[model samples]
Target: MAKRSLPILSDGAAKKILRDLCKQHNVSLELVTQMIEIQRENLGRGRQIGITQDFSAAIAEFLDSASIVRGE
Candidate 1:
């Protein structure tokens, strides 16, 4: 069987979908906004670490941060 691929959405399209889903489900848009901010920060950090060629450090940092956020 051939592998299937999902369609990539632009930022506006993705945000609109998320906003609609959130509204339908009575979810808070602020929560969605925070999630996006966290992801963007992680991406920026990863890009910075990539320039330094420290993927292991990046993985460790991400794991540590995630654990802290989850109160693990």
Candidate 2:
């Protein structure tokens, strides 16, 4: 079997990607960061009881609703 190498991004590149994504979505970096933390916490809590959910999609929907509510 051939060994496969994983792609890596430098810290600067990662930050740039995040910044661009936030700009493209017209959302503040702080808001996105907070949502990510909340989603992670929820996922962790769910895992304690062996519950699994497609939280990524849920988070996206939440962000959309939040943006609409904020008139963004």
Candidate 3:
């Protein structure tokens, strides 16, 4: 059998996923927005590229840490 591949999400789709996750988890949208801004700043003055995975990873990590902190 051939290995299955995941489809790449568009930027808007990825943002929506992050936003929804925040809402579902009771995480503040403001914090998520700040996290996104921090990621963009970290990318610096180069052409922005491959942001989908980075954004998703940031949200996932933030959620993980938040849960750990809250002992959820």
Winning candidate number (lDDT): 3
Please rank every candidate by lDDT, starting with the best. 3, 2, 1
Cα lDDT, all candidates: 0.56, 0.59, 0.66
Q: Model 2 RMSD to the real structure? A: 9.0
For model 1, give the 10-residue run with minimal summed lDDT.
Answer: 1-10
lDDT pick, better of 2 and 3: 3
Please list the residue runs of candidate 3 whose C-alpha ends up more than 4 Å from where it truly belongs after superposition. 1-47
Task: Tell me the TM-score of model 3.
Answer: 0.37
lDDT of 2 by residue, 1-72 (tens): 442322222367776788798899786666566555555555536353422344455567767988799899
What's the lDDT for residue 55 in model 2? 46
RMSD of model 1, in Å?
A: 11.8
What lDDT tens digits, residue by residue, belong to model 1 across residues 4-62? 33222237777788779879976555555554444444553635444333434454665
Ranking by TM-score: 2, 3, 1
Off by over 4 Å in 1: 1-16, 44-72
TM-score of each predicted structure versus truth: 0.36, 0.45, 0.37
- Flag regions of model 2 displaced more than 4 Å: 1-10, 47-72
